[model samples]
Target: MNTPDTHSPVLEVQSRRRPLAWLVAIALVVLAIDLGSKMWALAELADREPVRLLGGALYLSFARNTGAAFSLGSGYTLVLTLISVTVVGVIIRFASKLRSLPWGVSLGLILGGATGNLVDRFFRDPGFLRGAVIDFFSLFDPYGQVWPIFNVADMALVTGVALAVLLELTGRRIDGTRAVKERKTAGPGTRDKAEQA
Candidate 1:
């Protein structure tokens, strides 16, 4: 008996590194952008002055947050610091499993955001592990409402979350698009099928 040809496209589809490499590349790019922007913001808004870049509605106001999202839980810089460190550690440890761009980007955003705030806690005024994160962007409403100030790091975190959600909803596989469809084709409740796909 003769075996089937193994060089055909279908048989050759299982081996590929393009997706993994692309994911890593995108992650690095985002990390660089996040870090660079934060550095620039720190220098440009040194005196905690608000820079009105577009007049009334949008402004770049320098401030600091020593808490979690939306400035909640203030005075917990140590807690926040520990959480950030844990997140970074976890991402680095499991990076090999982040097989898609969205996963990689999410981790990258998280890592960069963590580093950004970590920088403040380590070097900003009030000494090590007690500094507040610098936030500079604000949205003003015509109805007299103001949004919380945020920095580049916050933006990355939000964007990454949004993308991850989108990818998950679309049934996009972490390994690749082919893997996603393959799993679906194998039907539900099949553990082996899911794993191989």
Candidate 2:
């Protein structure tokens, strides 16, 4: 008569749950910051000249973007909105497989950023699913002549994507495992011991 191995199962469950918790917490924080910044920009920067900062390296100017990131795909607000919705759905579907802290963080940033812009598409001015996104941060030029005006959501999306790409290139799996490369044996007759066994 031996005691049961209760600790293993409990630890496994906690490991699975921890990643999801991090994902949700990070996503909520990103969403809140994006929304808050947008609100502040709308209230304080409206109808005002661009506020220069960092010796003109950055400018805070209000802008309503009717397009995707970097002001691309203008005149296609509805299509862009649909695309964002699809992205959010995909992230949610993938969340169930999250078992790595880094993957969780990457997905969380993407989900939060996508949701932030989606909110604007649904609730901002000019009607539902066709509303413009509030943008305030500008680089180099105030009128967005040098660079497109952007917001916090765009920043998060870009950062998340870059991190995800880096993780993939580094062979970091979503299950917290490092991918291993298989080595080939020299010569045709050289069979590996494992294969022979």
- The prediction achieving the highest lDDT against the true structure is 2
The whole-model lDDT of each prediction reads: 0.66, 0.86
Which candidate achieves the best TM-score against the true structure?
A: 2
Candidate 2: lDDT of 159? 87
Instruction: Report how far off residue 163 is in candidate 1 (Å).
Output: 2.0
Ten residues in sequence with the least summed lDDT for candidate 2 = 188-197
Candidate 2 off by > 4 Å? 1-7, 186-197
Question: How do the residues 35-115 of candidate 2 rate in per-residue lDDT, one tens digit apiece?
Answer: 999999988999799999999999998999999877888899999999999999998888887778888899888888989
